[model samples]
Target: MTMSSLTFLDRERSVAGPGYSRWLVPPAALAIHLCIGQVYALSVFKTPLVARFGTSETAIAIVFSIAIVMLGLSAAFGGKWMERNGPRKAMFVSAVCFSSGLLIGSVGIATGQLWLLYLGYGFVGGIGLGIGYISPVSTLIKW
Candidate 1:
């Protein structure tokens, strides 16, 4: 074969076969998970909410509890969705929902609307956490 033809063949083989270094994928996934877990650190937002809205600590705590409960529910029920849709797609969707929740919560805080906090952080972000939590579990298990 010509030099160009040989190069083309090599490229095709790399693309068609197991092209990734399996060792690298796990560490990369770990890094991503660690970063994403910071979502749980959302307690950091509580002080600002309290300062701005003058809401009680118990009320703010309830919001966090609701989000956690929803996260658990979504993970349990959405596992099948994750399985059918594939982890990458599920993760993408989860990230969008999660980010959107933060944005909505910010808007709610700015507007002084407590309900928006519930809708945004508790509901939307909870769903993201749920989906994200499960997205990788089955994938890793299969691997």
Candidate 2:
């Protein structure tokens, strides 16, 4: 977390130098934002999820609700940690969490477990979304 504790994903190595171009940062940020923004497409699966889970529409909606709520909370709380740790590390962590959440959700869907879906795509993935959403902000501002 500290400069002395920098690891492979640490931001120290990524620090823009005199010749660095700010243009590159926006593309990287946009790419990440685009990936994280897929959650906005959750509605596309709404009816299918409801049918697959044999649950009420409101129940299925909770999954998205949870994800959105987690996104807000994580972004609010994680912004500082993202800054302190640097975007490189934050992005890696976000990717891991988001991917893991998707895997977990897949298993849940196969096993027919609603809670797993809630825990995975909703909670875990949401954290990824939040961190990913905020990680680029600091870097963009720094430039």
Candidate 3:
């Protein structure tokens, strides 16, 4: 075949069959995850919590640390589940858990309840982070 024909065939193969649109999925996925990654921005709420609850910085920092540790643990344990369930479902669940944690944490701060912060931001939100992190990793590897 001519050089031109070879190039055309390559292009055809790249776009054909079970193959995806090379130009689309990556950026679309990145846009979504960028928004979701805001969970890691939890520190933004720390000052407000301290202001409302009059809690010590050490206490607040401990709360954040618990959340991070839980996140890591959940991801480690749930990575297989994420891969089996698919990224979209995993991401949706993660969003719900993460948001719920923040809301609960807000209530805890308003009421001066430290336990609520642990429940909301540490356990719930941590689970969300774990699931969200694993959800995309496998998908990208497969892709």
Candidate 3 lDDT over residue span 26-137, tens digit each: 6756775685576567678778767866887777777778887877898898887665655666777888988898899878877889889888988898888777777666
Q: lDDT of each structure?
A: 0.76, 0.88, 0.73
What TM-score does candidate 2 reach? 0.91
Question: Across residues 24-125, which tens digit of lDDT does each residue of candidate 2 receive?
Answer: 988998898899889989889988888889999898889899999999999999998887888888888889989988988888889889899999999999
Question: Whose TM-score is higher: candidate 1's or candidate 2's?
Answer: 2
Q: The CA-based lDDT of model 2 is what?
A: 0.88
- Write down the lDDT that model 3 would get: 0.73
lDDT of 1 by residue, 65-107 (tens): 8788878998999899877767777787788888888888888
Error of 2 at 95 (Å): 0.7
TM-score of 3: 0.73
Ranking by lDDT: 2, 1, 3
Evaluate model 1: give its lDDT.
0.76
